[model samples]
Each structure stands twice: as structure tokens, then as C-alpha cells.
Target: MHSTPWSSAHRLDPADQHLRDFLAPRHSPAGDGVELDVDTLLSQKYNGVVELRVQVAAFSFQNSPSSQNAPRLLLDSSTPLNGVLEALSGDATYAGCGRCSAELSTDANGIYSPCYPCLPLTGVRRYYRPGVLTVSGRGYSQLCVLAPPVPLQKILKAPPDKLHRSSAPGSQVKLIQVAAERLHALLSLPKKTFVITIRSHFLCDENSAPLSQDFTLLDLQLPTDCK
Candidate 1:
């Protein structure tokens, strides 16, 4: 027998199994729905309209979005997440207002060794910020990495110009969908590595507190290195 790159020697772990189920391909033999095969993609020379099965997310709202039941969602691994972020129900992504201890900087090597910074903090609201992520070790480093970031936004407003080019791992990043029941787990983050991103207009009641933490949902994800 021959072993290929996808041979049984490598398979998704239980934690990763859901990711495969979350992002569906354009074409599948399982359903009668339209499918886009390699032949079609090649026929267009890789440029044309394409369809994808989205992971529609809806929150069971009862009170405030800032409460433990905040609005949030996770997409594929974190690789091409930004490109498809808007496609996930056309929701808006809010920026973080949290302040790092001090001014931070990055290097051409794509490693952040000085002070840390926060994520995409771009929203109409003020005085409020997104969640906080800290790494612990004998000595650690923090870099606000953007997956193929929003181009100019990711570079200009980003940690640095080289940031948008930093994420060089495989195209798969573990996305965490914090279920209300397991919200507490967010505190530990198990491995202590993840991305706490958000979506806009994730309202649960008639009233909206754009500045309130309620508008933010917890994104308890694994770092971009999970099989």
C-alpha cells in the first residue's frame, strides 16, 4: 500500500473534527445541491462566482448581549477567516479598546518581542474594548497577528507593516465557538492560546449597547497549530 499526504497516518482529532464539519466545500456528493469540482474551477482558470455553505450562527437572546450570553462565532481555522468573515452573515467586526501596558513594536522577522498590542479596534463606539489575551511562560512574546488582514487596515493600523505577512502556518487555525453553557471555560482557554474576535449587531433585545461588553461574544479558540 502507498501512503499519501492525507493518508490515515494523519486524521483530525476530536477537537478538530467539528472544524471540518463547520466549513463545507462548494461541491459535495452527499447532497443534490450544486457542487463546484476541480474541473469547473480550472475551467474558469480560477476566477468566477463560487458558492459556499456558510455556518449560520444565531444566539438565543434573553437579556443583554454583554451578559455571559454574548454574541460570537468562529470560522474555519484562522487562515482565510478574514476573507470569509464578512460572508459569515454579513456581520460587522468590532475593534478592541483594551490598552497594552506600553507602546509595542515588531521586527522584519515577524516576531513581537517588546510590549504587546490589541486587536482590530475599529468601531463607532468608544470607552469600550474587546477581550484580553495573555501568554505565560519563563518568558513569552505577544504579537497581534492578522490573517491576510484587511490589507491597508491590517498593515497601516496593524501592529506593523510586516504583520499582515506574519501568519505563515498552514491555512488552518482552530476557531472557538463559546457555547453559553461552556462560557466559563473561556477563562482558562485550556492551552491558553486563542483569538477573541467579534461580530456586529449581535443584539438579543430591542435595546443596543454598542459600548457595552454585551455586544462582544467570547471567541475561545486554539492557536493556529492544531491538526
Candidate 2:
């Protein structure tokens, strides 16, 4: 397993039989591979108090960042509506990407501060089609999908803003923050698979080949018919 800056962070649900079956072998396929993803569903509210539930998966990706994009993890949610809107409106935070480096604020006792500083993704763009969400960043590119909520045929789509070069190694991904009022509706949408494409600035190995590829597909089982 790759080492991360954090010594102890939350691991994926071990109870997930399917994820265990897939990750049992710590090997990255030179090309492609797929496993029956069986992991617990994640639901949490953000600062806007928007509720988000997404399936979580851990996979050995080719171009994934080494320690720079620490926390060494990625997340996917069936939140095209939530995701795109957040992106356009600029309300999402990039989690598990870079470590925060902020000054510590201490109490009267002079105890170290609890809050940590974090780095956010810079120079990224996100757009929504009826069915798909497209993201482009300095060295990263991504596509997000929310299913059944709206049939692909009924959905009109548009391209994401073009990304300009950045000092980072991969194209940056967009983080969407949602409104509290929209949280319940986001959670209420019919469950579907959420797919995210990660393009890392790092190469697969020593070859210097790009490390951007599709990671795991998380299935969020939402209830209700997508209009």
C-alpha cells in the first residue's frame, strides 16, 4: 500500500466483502481491470448542510498522485445535479487532495490548535449536460454521471471550460458545495452509479506516461423516479 502523510485516517469499510475481494491483492493492472464493487454507502452533510450519499471504492489507479495529493483517496457521488450546480456556483471543497498548511491557533493553555490548513485545487472548470458533468483542471480531467434521475435522452449537455496549464502535475478536479435546501432533494434522487475520471499529473510508473484514468464506479442506490 502507498504511504500517506496522515498516519491514521479512516479506511474503507472492511465489512465490504466485494471491496475486500478486489483489493486483497495490492497490484495495479498495467492496462485495465474491474471488480464487483461492494462497499458501504456514505451520507454526510456539508457546510451548506446539503446531504450527500455516495458509494465509496478504493482502487489501484495508474497515475494517482503520490504524497502530494495526500490522504491518498478519491470519492464519487451520484450527484450530477448537485455536483454541477455546486461547480457552477462554486461551492465544493476538494477533500483528500492536498494537506492544509495553516497557522495554529492555541487556547489560553497554549495547547496546539486542532484545525489544520489545506490546499485547494486551482484552475479548474466544471459544466453539466443533462446527464453528465464534465470537469477540467490544470493537469486533470473528469466526467461525472448520475443515472435514472433524468434519462440521457432528455438531458442536454455542455462542455466544461477549457483548462489552462498549472504548476500541479494533474488536471485539477472541481469541488461542489451545495445549499442546505437542496440537500434533501439531492439525497432523495433515485440512486444510480457515480463515475469520476481522475487524471493525475504523475505518470503510471517510471515511464513518464500520464497517470489519468477512470477509477472505480460507485453506485449510490437512491429511491424515487428521476424526472
Candidate 3:
């Protein structure tokens, strides 16, 4: 195994911190000869998104004559976009304000109402409405969540411009759901390396005379213990 060091900084909400803590070395069994350590160099929220950089280090306690140090891998992992959206959906504080319909703010912990004096002190009800979810990573193509769960057949037949301009709520949710499920399936497999590409096409102009496509390649290296 090879060793690669990675580092980054970003703000994490309570939820993100909880996940980080769960992945820390203290939570895992140290007696198994394998140890995991996750380090967050920095975390902060900017432009309504929580951005952070992290380093995940794996250590081996088993003695080996051939190599003294356990193999290390630096991976570029993004918080699952679908997971974030689902989390927001379940939290009441992040829902749009009842009076203004303004979207609520979110952090590591969950959602919160905007700092406005006119906001009611009570009646902050929880809602199950789905909002727009967008996915973007270093090598992955960006995807926006759709409302109303548009049918795949209809999506194919509709012009790319229509899809982009569609205001229907929950239009892109189905696509994200499928993508997230597929990724989950890939991660569950016993594989050392996983590689896949996600592709999306869009109309180049309003006239629908030509089309352009975006491609994102996902290359991941599973931890030694995972295999």
C-alpha cells in the first residue's frame, strides 16, 4: 500500500461534526490491529454552504517485516449531496419561513430560521417539503435536484432547455435518488478500486439545434480493511 497525505479546512455543522466523531479512531476497535483517524484541518460556512477539508489516516498495529508503515491513501470525498438534502428535508428549522417563504439557513447541526425580528416566536412548524439539491465535486458533474419526480421517459423526450427551465418542485429528485443509490451500491461491494463516470447532456441553445454534455469521473480507493 502507498501513503498519501491530504489536508483541507472548512466549517462543519453539528451533524457533520457528529459524523466526523463517529469516524474517529476512538469509536473503532483498536484491538483489531487496525486504527482509523479523521482530522479536520479547518471548517467554515461560506455562501450558504458548509465547506471543510479533512484528512483520513489509517494505521495498522500488526507487525510486518516487509513494511513498517501501513499503506495510506488520500481520497477526494464530498459529503453525499443526497444525504445533505434529505437531512434538510427532515429538519423543521431549515424549512422556508411561514410568513415570508424565505429559505432557512443550515449548518452542521441542522437548519435555523433567518435572523429577522418579524419572524414569529411560535408556530415554527416542521414540513416535509423537498427543496433544490445540487451536487458538484472535483471530478463529478454537477446535478440539481428535481421536484415532483419527473418521469425518466418524459425527461428524455423533453427538450434539454425545458428540463433546465422547469420550475416544477421535486423535478430533479428522482435523478439524485438514483445516483445516490447507485453510489451506495458500489461502495458496498468488496473492491479495492472503483471507477465510474456520470454524464449529463444539455441543450446548447434555446432553439435546441445542438446539444452539449458534461462528464464526471469518479475514482475511489476503498480502505484496506473495507476489502
Candidate 4:
């Protein structure tokens, strides 16, 4: 059996057969060589909180810092929608090709038509169409996704008045600080495993009317020590 970052060698409980089956690898039409399996360590729900931990097999960034010393702000793409298009289309060239022309094929004479396939048609080309011989449009701009963690200590130290405020720009900032503090405190703990407690509440409508607020922890940033 192949070992994944998240997989363990220990056997699972027979009583958890359903969970085992769910974790089993599933075939992909992409091909056996490309078969994909969930790289998850665990997923469970208790009360109103749902928790999940998974390993990333692979990932790509549309825009990355040009150099280690590059300004963090400059690393962001000027146009984010275009960045997404570039990622999905395998960069500007492929995206341009897709937008500007149709697929090329051989003529009865065996002469390649619509220009010979771009030299070194490998890698992403094997899975997707390549860009046109010439530029198609202005092309895609860079973009990125950022999720910074907060420390738990900051939250605990936040002013009482700010915490009580229901809505305000400063209040939002205070909340973020508090969350960071909490996260920092958790990471500082000596335990290898930790459980985070999240509270859920109802959201108000435009008129400030209460709406069902089933809070879900979508993301968490672990401290470098834990990593």
C-alpha cells in the first residue's frame, strides 16, 4: 500500500467499517495512473462543530513572490479573476489558445494544419490544450489567497467594550486580534494533539433580524512550532 502524509500504519476498528470504506481509494476516469484518493486524517462532527484534517497532495500558486526578498504586497496579482483563468487554463498561453482558435488536425496530405503543435508540447499540454502560436489577449494577471493566523492571547486581552460591540470596523479588528491570540495559545501547548472550541451564533438580516447561524470552522492556521 502507498503511504500518504496523512495515512497511518495502524489498523482501524472493525466497528468503523463505514469510515474505512469512505476513506478507501476511488478510481478516476482520468486514468489509473491518475487515480486520486482522499488524503484525510480525520473528519468528524460533534454538537454544532465539524472538524477535518487533510493533507495536500499537490498545490499551485498563480502568483508567487519573484524573489525571497520581494515585497509581500507586490506579490499579489493586479487582476485576480484573470489569475484564476490562467490557473484553470494552464497559464496565459494555453488560455489564449483556447480563446483565439480551434483544435488543429492533419490534412489528407498529412501536412500539419493550423501551425505545427507548439514545440515541446509536454507537461500541462498532455492534459490540456496549449496556447495559440501568437498572443490572444492582454492575458491573465496575478492573484493569491492569503490566510494568516491569530494568537489566542490577544483575544483574551482585548478591551471588554470592543468585544461587546455588535458591529464596527474597530470591533472587527479586535475580533481578529483575539482569534490570533487564541491560536497562538493553542500552539504553545505541549500536547501533540489539541481540540479547538468554536462557538456558533445566528446572523442578522438587513433589518438586524436573527438568522440561523450554524458556524463552521473553515480554516485554521497552526503555529510554526506545531507545523
Which is the leading candidate under TM-score?
2
Quantify all predictions' global Cα lDDT against the true fold.
0.28, 0.29, 0.31, 0.29
- Write candidate 4's Cα lDDT for 1-227 as tens digits: 99769765876787797877998999542122211111111111122332322221112222222233532221112324333333333321111112233334446996434432543442121112211110011122111112211222221333322333433565554433442333333323242232222322345568755553343222333444443
Estimated TM-score for each candidate: 0.17, 0.19, 0.17, 0.17
Candidate 4 overall Cα lDDT vs. reference? Answer: 0.29
Better of 1 and 4 by lDDT: 4
lDDT of 1 by residue, 46-144 (tens): 322322211112111122133446544333223242333232213222222334322223369854443223445322211111222222222232212
Best by lDDT: 3
Error of 3 at 225 (Å): 21
**Clash count list over all predictions:** 9, 17, 24, 13
User: Which 10 consecutive residues of model 4 have the lowest summed lDDT?
Assistant: 129-138
User: Candidate 2: minimum summed lDDT over ten consecutive residues — where?
Assistant: 40-49
TM-score between model 2 and native: 0.19
- RMSD to truth, every model: 23.2, 21.3, 26.1, 24.4
The regions of model 3 sitting more than 4 angstroms off are 1-112, 116-173, 192-227
Query: After superposing candidate 2, which stretches have Cα over 4 Å from the reference?
Result: 1-31, 39-87, 91-158, 162-188, 194-227
Task: Show pairs that collide, candidate 1.
Answer: 65-214, 66-214, 77-173, 78-173, 95-120, 95-121, 95-122, 96-121, 97-129
